[model samples]
Target: MKKITVLAGDGIGPEIMASAIAVLQATASNYEQNFQFNNQLFGGAGIEASGRALPEATLQACYDADAILLGAIGGAIGSPWEKAKQTPEQGLLALRKALNLFANIRPICVPDALLPLSPVKEAIVKGTDFIVVRELTSGIYFGEPRQLQETKAYDTCRYTETEIARIAHKAFQLAQTRRKKVTSVDKANVLATSKLWRKVVTDVAKDYPDCTLEHQLVDSCAMRIVQQPTDFDVIVTENLFGDILSDEASVLPGTLGVLPSASHSENGVSLYEPIHGSAPDIAGKNCANPASMILSAALMLRQSFQEEKMAQSIEDAVFAVMNEGVVTPDLGGNAKTDEFTAAVIKKMQS
Candidate 1:
């Protein structure tokens, strides 16, 4: 049996998680697969229940599981936790660190039906399919000596050759399977860290002689993503740039509600979650879109379980439902969250 740690975090987390789980259960049942799902509290739920955002029990549960499914985290922008010494996001960061989930992968694909919904013109977004392999554990977010003072507060952006090589290898391997092209995005002209990034990635590329490599400044990469998104196949970047660019690329699919993310370590342990955060306003309303969460489960099936057929089944079901206009409020449809999820499950079962 495949073990999964289910963390239904905060806000609309429970709602979307319930939907995603329903679909996951359906997939397992139909495919004669066994999934042992262990539910654990995390994020704001953890704080409220035990005064800790990532309780020890929760961490232990995740450690024992083969994979993790996260709904969402955080609460309202100016809520109590935001002002507290410990915030909901700390739990997520801590979880990633403890799990050693150094590689974050986000796929961006624009469906034909949602072409009109994207901010970019249909011509640019059409046939746009690329995956961003982000170096998650290091870079500015985790760099040491970050300090705040009266006037000269500063944060460091640092990376090692080892960090750059691993993620670059991952990106290249992924590219070899797809378009045989990997675009390494960095500000090599300015940032010293980015210069090291470019150098290490170039060295890694030599090993993957079958894969083509190109270097682009993060600024131009950002512009090209909107202008000619289809030109990219696989993009590998550092943490801060990936964090920003993934969110930007997600919109090309028409909504952030449709984007899922997977963070993995060198080992098999990985965490899956929708890119969109917890929507406190829609908590318990049954109006939030569950597509991203459902898709995250699809990612887990493919990456962790190695059940490519089951993963494709989930993806096809999602696409079928969306094509039929069976979506929640965020997708400009009247169907409730559960209703939309039910449609996807039905499609998968059929």
Candidate 2:
């Protein structure tokens, strides 16, 4: 049995996590694959329960688990960081560091079913499939000597060669599997960190001769994401740029509710979560989209347990259900979270 730690964070987190769990259970039953899911407190829920976001017990559970599936965390954007105590996003960042999850893989694919919903023209957004490989544990997010002064506050953005190399290698290897194109996005023309990023990524590309390597400044890359999205296959960049660019790329699908991400480490334990955050406004409303969380579970099965058939079946079931006009509020459908999840499960069982 695979031990999957479930962190159903704050807001709509619990509801969507329930959907992912139900779907996983259904998939396991159909495939005869045993899965043991252990629900644990994290994010704002953890702070409320134990005065700490990444509670010790929860962290321990994650370390011992085969994999982790996380629902959304934090409040409606800026609200979580307003308080003096640790924010949910901070806890999440800490979790990434503790696990040494250096590579965050976000796949942005505007499938044919989601074409009508996309803001971009169908001729441009159609068949737009790409992956953003982000350096998760370092860069400005973890940089030292940061201070919030009364007049001038600043955060450091630093990286070592080793840090840059591993993520670069990850992107190139992943590109080899996809379209053999790795586009390293950075502000190389100005920033010192980005210059090093471009140089190191270019160096790493030499190791993967089969994979074609190209460089694009982060600004132009962001513009192209909305203009010529299909031109990119694998976008590799530092934590900050990757964070921004991936969110920008998410717009192609018309909503963040359909995107799933995986943060992988050298060790076996990895994390799967939706690209969207906790919609505090919609918490307990049963209106949140559960497809992202369910797809994150699919990513967990495939990447962690090597259960490709089971994973693809779950993903196919979701797409099939969505194509049948079953979607949540964010997708312009009226189905509640549970109802939508049940529809997907029913499709899987059939």
Candidate 3:
């Protein structure tokens, strides 16, 4: 049996994750795979229980499991203790670093049924399918030499040859499988780190000669993303840039609640999560959408377990549900949260 750790975190997290677990159980049974899930606490609940955002026990559970599924983290409620020291967001960042999850893959594709909801014209979004391969470790976000003075603060942006090579290689390999094209986004013209990034990625591209490669300045890439999103296939960039671009690209699909992301390690340890936050405004309300969480489970199956058929079944079911006009309020459909999840489950069983 494959062991999996489920972190049903704050707010709408538990509700949405419950739906994902149900789908996974059905998929595993149909595929004749034995799977066991071990639930653990993290985020706000973890902080309240253990005085730390990421407890040692939670980390151990993640290490022991074959894969991890995380619902959203953080909550609007502030802890009575040191606010900065007790925030739940730290738990997520700490867990990511501890697991060595260096690659984050975020796929953004506009479902055919939701084209009308897209801000972009239908013709521009008709066949828009692309994936963002982001370097999760070793970049400006975690770079060293960060310091704050009495009046000013500074953070260093750093990268190594190996860090660039690994993520670049992943991007090229992904390009070879998908569209035979890769766009390396960097600010090489301005930053020394990006120059190193450009040099290293260019060197790595030679290994995958069949995969066409190009480098674009980050500013221009950001502009073109909204102007001509369909032109992109696979986008590879550093942590900070990828974080901004992926969020921007998500708007093309109309709702942030519909996107899912996966962060993985070299040894196959993976964590699946939605891109959106714990919207404290809708904390206990059933109005929050669960599609992103369900999609994250699909990514967990595909990237970690290598269950492509089952993963595709989940994806098709989601699309079919939306195509039939059954959707959450966020997607402009009348279906309630339970109703939408039930539709997906029904489609999966059918």
For model 2, residues 309-329, the per-residue Cα lDDT tens digits are 999999898888889999887
What TM-score should be assigned to candidate 3?
A: 0.95
Model 1 scores a C-alpha lDDT of 0.89
Model 1 earns a TM-score of: 0.96
Off by over 4 Å in 3: 77-86, 148-150
Model 1 alpha-carbon drift over 4 Å, by segment: 150-152
Clash list (residue pairs), candidate 2: none
User: Sort by lDDT, best first: what order?
Assistant: 2, 1, 3
Ranking by TM-score: 2, 1, 3
User: For model 3, what is the alpha-carbon lDDT of residue 286?
Assistant: 72
- Per-residue alpha-carbon lDDT of candidate 3 for residues 1-350, written as tens digits (9 for 90 to 100): 87989998888888888888877887778888777989898888787888877788999999999889888888765634236464677678788888988889988899887798888888887778899999987787778799879999989898999999999998998898999889999999999999999999999999998989999999999988888888999999999899899989877887877889999887758899988877777767776778888899888888888889988999999888988988777777778777788888889898
Query: Candidate 2, after superposition: displacement of residue 314 in Å?
Result: 0.8
**TM-score, one value per model:** 0.96, 0.97, 0.95
